[model samples]
Target: MVVQESGTPRELEHHLRPSTVKGIDFDQLLEPLAATAHGAANKRPITGVSLNPQIVQPGDVFLAISGAKRHGAEFLDTAIANGAVALITDEAGLNLLAEPASIPVAVVSDVRKIAARAASMVYGTAKNCPELLAVTGTNGKTTTTFMIRAITEALGLHAGLVGTIEMSARGQIIPSVLTTPEATQLHGVLARMNEQEISTVAMEVSSHSLSYGRVDGLQFAVSGYTNLTQDHLDLHGSMEDYFQTKAQLFTSGHSQRAVVMVDDSYGQRLAQNASIPTESLSLDAHTNADWHVVNIAPSVLGHQFTIVHRDGREIHARTGLPGLFNVANAALATVMVLASGVALEQLQEALKQADPLSVSVPGRMQVIGESPVAVVDFAHNSDAIAKALESMRVTGQGRRIIVFGATGDRDKTKRPDMGAVAARHADIVIVTDDDPHGEDPEPIREQVAAGAQAVIDAERAAVQLFNIAPRAKAVEFAVSLAGVQDAILVAGRGHEVSQDVAGIDVELDDRVELANALKLHGFVTIY
Candidate 1:
């Protein structure tokens, strides 16, 4: 697979840790390990924590977890060579270690479970963590977190963000490697935010993070659920498994309260069964939710809507981003802040004055052109593709044109579904390569194209389909074929800067490619 790194191993290691750390007693930090201590390990102070042996540094406790291919004890020598002072691992890892090891060792039954707690103790984040607000689901996690950060900022609070696109602490942005970072990096980032005096944090909690104990030690002030759909089946194996993984974030252990969207069955089930005080939100006024959206009308910015509470409270809001889904995201953000104890009157004032919901999220319905209106979005899955295309529908003579492709080596079952969604929504569909990591590009394209072709043949649909490789050419072709009144959507890999093709990184940014193509086609380009 094409492995993308944010930086060199050493640089990334340094970047993940906070600049300043208060050393903690190793024995005290090991209290949460829940295992007997072995070896000649003393109660020395530890300055940092890391799970990666390549990034281990002096005074750091290295966590060795077993992997599918190899045990982490295999890298014990490398971690020690890089200056790891102590080791935390399972019995399997301890058994693999050589006799008479130099450093101290602690053996746990499950390393992943206690890794976050240990890191939190070492980084001093468990007690000093900022007001944490989190969102988890198949989609809308990133946008909702961004919206939460925006609203928090509008209220004159310094807010930090951790999500799919990037992580930020008081406006210092760092490109993120995962939707939710590993426990070591997560605690370190939280420590840094605390050091910077950031009062609130909006983070996207992914299913993988929840399932893997990445967020084990975090107790969110408020957590939210958007919706679950057919994405990441490769990881979870089934939709039910994916739902359960996301459900972990809403329990009393993980969050104090919850704001759940009951528009879908999964959401409905979650809200009903969540082991915490939960507030239900729905676009349907008749759904009997704690919060309901009404008076949705298109505006110059986007759609203006009103959030109505069951207790006769009302807040008017608007989002600059298009689509009904964005409206849901904005409403979710508003209620999450309200749940965090922001007064309704104060939040309404902030919405009226600052319009925090109007903030633009990177690569999410990001507009690159005014004429032949072009957009770059991260809509790789079937549900997201349908929503994106529906939102970009043209009026009168304008046609909806879409250029997208399936991500390789990920949920191969969704490829055909994504194509079918495109064929049903767009008048023209151009299938291109998107991150063909370790998988042949052509076979992936054929599967997607086959789905589109099936729809065209079965229903006699008047949809035009094209299979193009090397995404840049596909974008160019879409722009060339579009009319001034048409709208073109370059979907999938929204803000990603590089394409993974058979273990090689081919540089490509959708916004830049789309903007360049629009200019080449004599169309008006937007920033």
Candidate 2:
């Protein structure tokens, strides 16, 4: 599927608005924007809202904000030609408008925030939204949100999901371009979910979404924190700034309650300073957290563990996905739902009957073969890469092989660390290209290889390293070199089907490539 352009309204053509929202007075729908503007007399009813000028429809209120490269007001002609009835913009945007504007314009200090508030009002999500659950972190956000949705469904309630992989309302599944949708599209999804009688929603809230005001004007019923690490420093610039951006979600304005994992220092700090009522979770039994995971044992699929509360209560649960991190994900999902007001006993029974925690999350520790144990995951960062490789380790003489690469135009600082982690964990490491968006792929691969080479030299390890290209060849090489007992991991790109290379779109799916490579080697694949 073609990835939609950023900020484009998606999955809203036929399902977003109900008949009741056919028209709403501009002043009523966007009172916040009108209250601060100069010419606000246009009282035309707004039937829709849009941020992208290309998708503007008749009777829509176009939101024009100041962008990094160009102001949204620069596209006023396009928005008007496409049928925008009114406009909401900042002073900078207002200055760009002609003296006699074709449409009524409302100026706001922050157009993005106003757009979210206006969308909420227009879509009836400001007051009638479903039980909102959100998870935010550097890693595990996707899996935790997916687990929340699974648990919600296991309890026999309709659930909607908006995350990195896809957005779903009722049965309509739309491919996701952003980890969190733009506010206008987000409110539209919530409204559609409300219309579909979905009682709950699970969403992945990225740091970019929170920093860019994509999740503004929304309140989550229960928000969750997994862990924060060295990633996204490209945008945030520093770890402190990144943590502060994520910290915004734990405040009273964003969520009513929170379930925070106190494993990392960031989570510990967030739990200590969070404004809302927060519940602490930890895998360490010694820590006096509200919830704890104990009695963990390896299972055929993954691991089974008990989620024990400090108040002498516990629920048994299991996950089909491997890795101790997945066990943390399952425990976090359980507590997040529990914090949302579900009875412990009822949740336990639903978990037992449905096995919701075992639900497959696309591209996340996704296993494709049994012999040689081929797997694909989205472990791009150092911490995630370390954990992923550790989880794939077996007791005997099975060599662990990893095929991975760092993304270009991202936090370049993490590239070496990711390589070092792979070298430390795997017997053989294959460095390859992973979506070198707008950057030269060779340098990116070299930097990663340099890190791995440093580790091999310093430790005098017996690990073999190879730098490959185009990704498909890397997977093929890994499979060819693997024995029946050895494991192969294709990391960095998981469920993604396309690669962005130097502004060009290239078709690629790691799972498909790995499966084909295994089949060519006469190895049995799980699928």
Candidate 3:
């Protein structure tokens, strides 16, 4: 089917639900698999499916997938009591059910691989669901998705967005716990968007999602790559493995076409090795690319740039989002729109009229104050922290002071790298607690502080370091030290509302705390 134009329906809704599952038999569906099941013949039909035992309802098939903590099959009794009509899991999970006859058990070897498609069968795909556009990268995924939504809406189309911040559609927004939801919830969200008459959607596809089978079996009309940096090594083990996992989205099964930003080596290789039709975008003038950005002007209000395609079409774009990196992000979003079948001319016109800064994703280079400039961003990685600090330095005149921290139990190796970046870039560095999930907050801070101390002592840099465990106090201290010409950057948790400390979500907002600190110091900001 051709991509639908703004205000035009591409196709009529065939069925409200994508599939007919009046009473899908469990045994029949599992018959093709080699999994051994003693009660295969006795399994009954199921009306729905769920992986989490906590949310299982009547007639739902509780999918007991194995996991690191404990096999999901361990929760079989919990699922059965919650009205699960049948169980679809591996041979191990089937063995967990003490009384297999209480509920039908059908074994599947690979639960993660089949969970998404199973959802597609039960809930049915949304009617006239918007063409799926997936964006994957180390950063900019959230910003780009929000950008696509802005550009799409500017064209008089209702577009839905699913990302780290929220899952929004039908005039409703829900806070998100994960960057990308698991397969069942992800498809359910997509179907919900379809029902809401959203003709287009932009979803942030995470590397973890790709590797864990979260995005398995979903179709994407177009997918995109922003850039890969050194983060998530804890989960993937090595940078090469991380890159390969991100590269999987560019293949035919996950996406139909790819729009890749070739500014980095990983991106360049991705463009070269992409299995599907690909479009190359670049910010550098000397590089050979299909989409080229030639000019960038950064101001206190943000930046403006120009983009030229291989067809000789040049378009002007502007963003209130500070930093030259945003120019790359805006350019990436521009091509994504074109790849989705929007007329390039239409997109160009929208860029001309739309306020790109107004489309900013929260906690992403979020400016909370101006005089003694205060900024908050989700720059937890070393590379991202460096870029964010540099972006803030150039935005306003004067010395830079950074308030940042590394999370616990996730990619511990990046902690020192982040500290070193802050030490080198900021005149003053405040090391604070980020998200110390289950681990003692002290060790994480010490590792990061050691990196900062190392850099400071190595160069005999005048950068002063303060180890502050309480994030709120850290913001206050930074604000107390800031002058009118200085910028205070609070990194790590951009839009996050709470601090994850020892497995508990402690309520803390950098923006709120920063604002309060500024107010306490009798300082007024341009914000």
Best lDDT goes to which candidate? 1
Candidate 2 local lDDT, residue 14: 37
The superposed Cα distance between candidate 2 and the true structure at residue 361, in angstroms, equals 0.6
**lDDT by residue (tens digit), candidate 3, 368-471:** 78777788888889878888888875335477999988888898888888888899989899998998999898889999999999999998478999999699
Off by over 4 Å in 2: 1-22, 34-43
Q: Assess every candidate by TM-score.
A: 0.96, 0.96, 0.91
Q: Among all windows of ten consecutive residues in candidate 1, which has the lowest summed lDDT?
A: 1-10
Question: What is candidate 2's lDDT per residue for 385-427, written digit by digit as tens?
Answer: 9999888845468899999999988889988888888899999
Arrange candidates by TM-score, highest first: which order?
A: 1, 2, 3
Error of 1 at 334 (Å): 0.7
lDDT of each: 0.89, 0.88, 0.80
Pick the winner on TM-score between candidates 1 and 3.
1
**Candidates ranked by lDDT:** 1, 2, 3
lDDT per residue (tens digit) for residues 1-527 in model 1: 21333666667666566787778877777776676778886666898888889888778998999989998888989888988888888888888876856888888898888889888888888788899999988889989999999999899998999988888876577779899999989998898888888999999999999988999888999999999999888889999999988998888889999999999999999999999999999998778689999999997637999999889899999998978999999999999999999999999999999989989887898889867778999998999999988888475799999999998899998898888889999999999999999999999999999998888888647899999988999999999999888999999988899999889889999999999999998988876
Error of 1 at 103 (Å): 1.1
Pick out the ten consecutive residues of candidate 2 with the lowest summed lDDT: 2-11
